[model samples]
Target: MKKVTLKKNLSAAMISLLALSSFGGTVHGESKTGINADAAILVNAETGKIVDKYNEDQPLGVASMTKMMTEYLVLEAIDKGKIEWTDTYKISDKVYQLANAPGLSNVPLRAGDAYTIKELYEAMVIKSGNGAAIALSEAVAGSEGEFVKRMNAKAAQLGMEHYKFVNSSGLSNYDMLGMHPEGTGVNDENMVSAEDMATLAYRLIKDYPEVLKTSGTNYKYFRKGTDEEYLMKNTNALLKDRAYSYKGADGLKTGTTPFAGSTFTGTAERDGVRYITVILDAKDQYGQPSSAERFIQAAKMLDYGFTQYETVQYTLDDTETKDALPVQDGKEAEVKITVDKPIKVRMMKKEIKQAGVELKLDKDKTGEDGKLQAPVEKGEKIGELVLKNEKEAEYILDGLQRDQKVNVYASSTVEKANWFVRSARNIGEFLKDIFG
Candidate 1:
């Protein structure tokens, strides 16, 4: 058997049955639901709330969606001053050959030809050019193999729960014309769970919003007004002017292969609210692989998000308790408690209705009588005020708790009571107990 991974062994009928069991059957209309993919996820870009998901944690082939990682590492290098947009690379023989490979998406590049980092970055981002991606990878880390290590390391740092990068371009090693990164199998392909892809997209947008400038563009000329000029059209069909154009569709990336089928990591913003959606190995109704199917599924995820979700702010007053915590051995008998700050969450209209905060105090800091010990400094962390939702347990994004919580701090300092005051209070309590 070949050493390939990420492709499922289920038949079309079995896949559909799995979808129905996982999502309660495909529905219709404005409340439309269900996605025809092996795995999918929708999330609030600002709040990191997973709005909905289907089999989002299963590791699967991501195809060129892996380029998002390549893009991230390049941007990071530029930000760290390790490289510059004006920096240039002389096309390597392997990259040059891959650029001209038949059937693979690429921008024309000749061996020994020098291209600026900016030009190659555009080719990779705007056109999903495999050669451009590999070239940029080599420039950033000195070799595609080293760059692949950086990609996996960055994925872990970004809180990605499940991912594997065998090569920078996401192409099967066999497709690399025998030039795939050393130590990786020739049949290997990049793999990531939909949840991890969402996490990657979130970190990309958060860490470098500048990427949208390139990914958002629908088309651009690789070498404008030159003899070797080649027009590169964005592979994202949801972009404006495309056959399946959608409003506010700007970035991020799309991919397809016999192994990965069709996948997309899409981001869009409208009225200041942004959402990130991921669809992996999307298939048509009959369970046949189709490039257009990913967009169709993405449309449903985006529509449900935009139409049903809203950003709501929860403040200190929203917490379940405003009661003061009794202080033991302090000059003052009690101290005020409240949430540290306001938290913003993107929730469905229904989730908002039942949304509220729950207060939890630290037991270690409290006395046997359930009172806080004295010498409490102003702004001391005593506990946490957590956002509570009835449906929170059902939310996806595996290994990610979506912990929307803030530290509960003391309103003011409560110094320890002097010996005299302590004695007096002790006597008073003794007398009260006897008289009662």
Candidate 2:
């Protein structure tokens, strides 16, 4: 087995991909955000910026949605040299049992079958196969219980509020071991909020965009060296066979269970911008006995996010703050610094506004009062550049309430001087300032 550290959600884990500010990112105002599902949320794929939401914080069965995290961990392991795409694992009695278990979603993993990691991953994500999910979890973490522990830990690390996992497959209301043997009665519904689902989707797409390549799949898959196969129709109706299909719609996962109702974490791209939306406990809005309320709502929400909002990229002036600040007791009286990276924020384009930037420094760097004192080195972190809304007195980004803080470093080295020389330089600077 290979060891891999799970990452927080992409916004939190992939700093290079999405540099969420410390105050988070500042939005001037809220957008129209309401959904019909029991819970739902729409977010920008790049920024993890929420455009709108409703009951997104309410916990409920995530069903096969749990497989998203499962896939994340598996891919994470493979990416870190822990496992290979072709690595294979033998089917345990548990997985085989799940295949034969009536009414449970599975890809028919017969006993004595050796399945490759990639094959099992597809079954879990594309088919929502419970057996394949357990097989992958056990292979990676040694046991389903241990695998679930990693899931919860990763969820918490991703800043999922009050989320919990009982099983890797999100099979709820069933005995934990009923399918495999070592069983107990644990109502592990795989609880998660719609907002968390959006976060999870954002990270998966941000860090593993490749996952979308398979989201369009709607078919029955076969295990390696096995003659048996099951029709693996994608649960996401928008992907195919529906009136809700939209341009740039691609891959994502859907989960449904007796208790979970119908839930989906969907993604699509339009005009160079991608959007992810989550709908939990969806309804049959059109009155079709099998109406795909999930897909309909998902399409509506995703469309709203894409057409109503846009991600803005702003670069700091060519230089870091562009001006050198006085440094006490340094050979050079002042030092310059540069912006570490450009700022990317999600905002509405209706009435665009330039994001406000505030440069903050450590008191010590500023000597005692708000001035810098030192032998500051080039590339040393002196402070951070914060992004704020011009209307901060009235608004904020809906979900990410914190301001964004980018690390600012000293651009040049400034060495300390002899006390006499330093004192003389300070006096001259003071006298010059006074005269000016």
Quote each prediction's TM-score. 0.80, 0.72
Q: Tell me how candidate 2 scores on lDDT.
A: 0.71
Off by over 4 Å in 1: 1-32, 46-49, 149-164, 270-273, 319-339, 392-402, 419-436
**Superposing all C-alpha atoms, what RMSD in Å does each candidate have to the true structure?**
5.7, 10.1
lDDT of 1: 0.83
- Model 1: how far is 332 from its true place, Å? 4.4
Residues 322-374, candidate 2, lDDT per residue (tens digit)?
A: 55677778888678777778766656676346555677886657766677778
Positional deviation of residue 182's Cα in model 1 after best superposition, in angstroms: 3.5
What is candidate 1's CA lDDT for residue 202?
A: 87
